[model samples]
Target: MPSRWIATFDEPALVAQALTALADLGVPGTRLVSPAPYRAVHLTGQPGPWRAMGWLVLGGGLCGLATAIALEVGTSLAHPMHVGGQPVIAWVQFGVIMFEMTMLGAGLTNFLAMIVLGAWSRRQVAKAARDGLRSDRLTLAIPTSGRSPEQLQAIRAALVGATGIEEAP
Candidate 1:
């Protein structure tokens, strides 16, 4: 596979144009790497904000529920002390534990989710070298496999001054 790269404007139109160009060029596999996220880029797959948060909320909610049940179960098993002649499932006390568990789990889950998704992780800073970049710079890179010479020529022509053509494993 012949890996290729391109640098485009930080705006959405240019990013879309670059992606469209790659698609139009009939590249086999393509990807976009950016200093900051491009909203439209990741709409199709994982590592986006909504997906990360959705999983975090779902997992955290399940964990919270489980924690509530576990707490109630362990307490019931270890010390079956009755207060006010209440039943084993004391609603008020359980409610407090549930609320605390939900908030704690949700917050920690979200925090870990962001970190896992490479939100604030370190990248090779020197890679994003260009002039007149905006607050967020988006770079699109595409990898081509088993291409004909004509196709490679076409891609090479398209990437006139673009840089950063490294292959990923």
Candidate 2:
């Protein structure tokens, strides 16, 4: 399959137009790369499929809370202990530990998810020219797989004056 096609834009309006043009052309995997967050370019179609992270974090937090309760209550019940004449299953004392564990679980899950998704990978650097996405440049990328030559020509024609139009790896 063909890789990605990158079209660089200097203005946000151009990026928006290019996005609309590509979407109208039925281009798949269309995306934008910018130096910083900008609201001008409104993407079409469904967003990226990363919504699972929220569910993953929630599951992790719940598991952490359950584990915390089991450890604190189960240990107290297994070997009854008394400290300061308080209840053996000290709910108040366990609050801090439960909070810490819940946070730890969510944080660790987020970190691992990012790693798995290649969010920290250095490979993306090699795809474009140096500072291509920095210093007032916005890039619109579309994967060229299964696209006809006519479609590719149409995309090239749509992105007039693009800084770069190349097959991205």
Pick the TM-score winner: 2
lDDT of 1 by residue, 1-169 (tens): 5334445444655666555665677664455555565664652122435555877777987798789879887878688887788877677778877888887888888778878755443232223322224465555545556677798678656544353343432
Q: Give the per-residue lDDT digits (tens) of candidate 2, residues 45-146.
A: 534335677988888888888888888899889999888999998889999989988888888887787677556333443366333668678877677777
TM-score of each: 0.60, 0.72
Lowest-sum lDDT 10-residue window in model 1:
123-132
Task: Name the regions of candidate 1 deviating beyond 4 angstroms.
Answer: 6-10, 43-57, 80-85, 117-136, 156-169
lDDT of 1 at 57: 75
Report the number of the highest-lDDT candidate.
2
Clashing pairs in 1: none
Q: Can you list the residue pairs that collide in candidate 2?
A: none
Judge candidate 1 at residue 118 and give its lDDT.
Answer: 57
Model 1's lDDT to the true fold? Answer: 0.59
